[model samples]
Target: MDNLLVKTGSSLKTFFTELGGISIMVFKAFAAIRIRHNFIPQIIEQFILIGKKSLPLVVVTSAFMGLAIGVQVGFQMTGFTPHWIAGGMILRTILIDLGPITIGLVLSGRISAGIAAELGTMKVTEQVDALRSFAIDPIGYLVTPRLIAAIFSVPALLVFSNSIAILLSYVSCNMTIHITWNEFVQGMRYSFYVSDLMTSLIKSLVFGVVLISLGAYFGLNCQRGAKGVGSATTLAVVWASVSVFVLDYVISTIVFYA
Candidate 1:
């Protein structure tokens, strides 16, 4: 019992410490962005990196997941006359939960690792050293644009995902069963409150910051050579996903009682 208590206490302490580090990373990222606005090429490159590169995967995942959600909900509502209550249900789930969450997760999995690996390689290869040697402020040049791009790109992905998910789900509803578009959309509008949509957007922003920060932190701080870079890349995605869920719970709880 004593050992278990000690272990639990140690876990809590580590958790808090990590949380504090994450917060510091976010603050530094914003500061870097402020200092690095002159680098238009870097900023645009990040837009392509974070937004364009991720679009295909985001679109694909949103469509299939939306269809799956429609199917499951349709199965559950089969006893109903129209059997098309599922469309609205799918829309609600996608808009309020899965759309943002899915995009956030995919961003973390793909872009977070990319950022970590890139920065980690730079760190190990002395490119970062060169920047520091030139007094270029490595964080301003390296972390800032990526962070800003993430803030913009994650939401862009979410907005696109939401539209795709809704469209695909609507297609599934009409194709599988036969519901009027007006009725289906009406049900969706009624079921999905604007407030929930706002909640989802807020979650996406938080997720964006968390994932980017985790990647930057792990990458910038990595030790050793190629092996350490690889390890940091893996850890960045893992920790980003974990932090997403943890932050999701906190957001949900606050929204619930607010």
Candidate 2:
């Protein structure tokens, strides 16, 4: 019992310590944005890397998710109800919740893991120290661009994903229940609201910041050697993914209530 209590206390301490570090890193990255003037090119490069390169995966996953939701909604509907309502359901589900959350989780796995591993490798190899020796602020040069790129790219990707998902859902509804494209589109138009769109974008932005900042934090503070790098990469992915869901709930509750 005593051993278990000690372990639990240690784990809690580590969690808070890491959380504090990530928060500090995020603040510093934002501050560094004003001080660092030469990262524009790198930011653009990261935008392409984080946003453009992620399009294929986002589109494919979102399309399939829409199809699945459409089919399921169709199955659950009674014959008396309009089939067109499936379109509204799909649109609402995708845009307001699933779309941003799904994109965040996907990026958390792909981008966060990649950032952690890349930075972790640099840390282990003394490359990060080399940058500092040259009077370069590693956070300004390395972390800032990635952070800015993520903030820009994630919302863009969410928009693309939401559009593709809606399109695919329309197609799926037509095939599944013979709902016409016009009816599906009309249903979507009727149900759509500007506020919902804004909410999704906000969620995407927050999730982007959370994942990228955590990735950089873990990578920068990674312990020595290959094992440490591996651990950081794994933790980065896990924590980023979990944070997306947690933030989703918190944001959604506040949005709905407020």
lDDT of each: 0.80, 0.89
What is candidate 1's lDDT per residue for 176-252, written digit by digit as tens? 66666887877776687777788788888888777878888888888889999989999899998887777877887
Residue 17 CA error for candidate 2 (Å)? 0.8
Best by TM-score: 2
Residue 67 Cα positional deviation in candidate 1, in Å, after optimal superposition? 0.9
Q: Candidate 2 on 1-258: residue-level lDDT in tens?
A: 999999999999999998898888888888888644467789999999899999999999998988887788778666798876877888889988999899998999889998999899999999999999999878988899998899889999999999888888777777778888888888888898888898899999999888888888889888999999999999999999899999999998988897
Clashing pairs in 2: none
Reference-based TM-score, model 1: 0.91
Span of 10 residues, lowest total lDDT, candidate 2: 31-40
Taking all chains together, each candidate's TM-score versus the true structure is 0.91, 0.96
Error of 2 at 252 (Å): 0.3
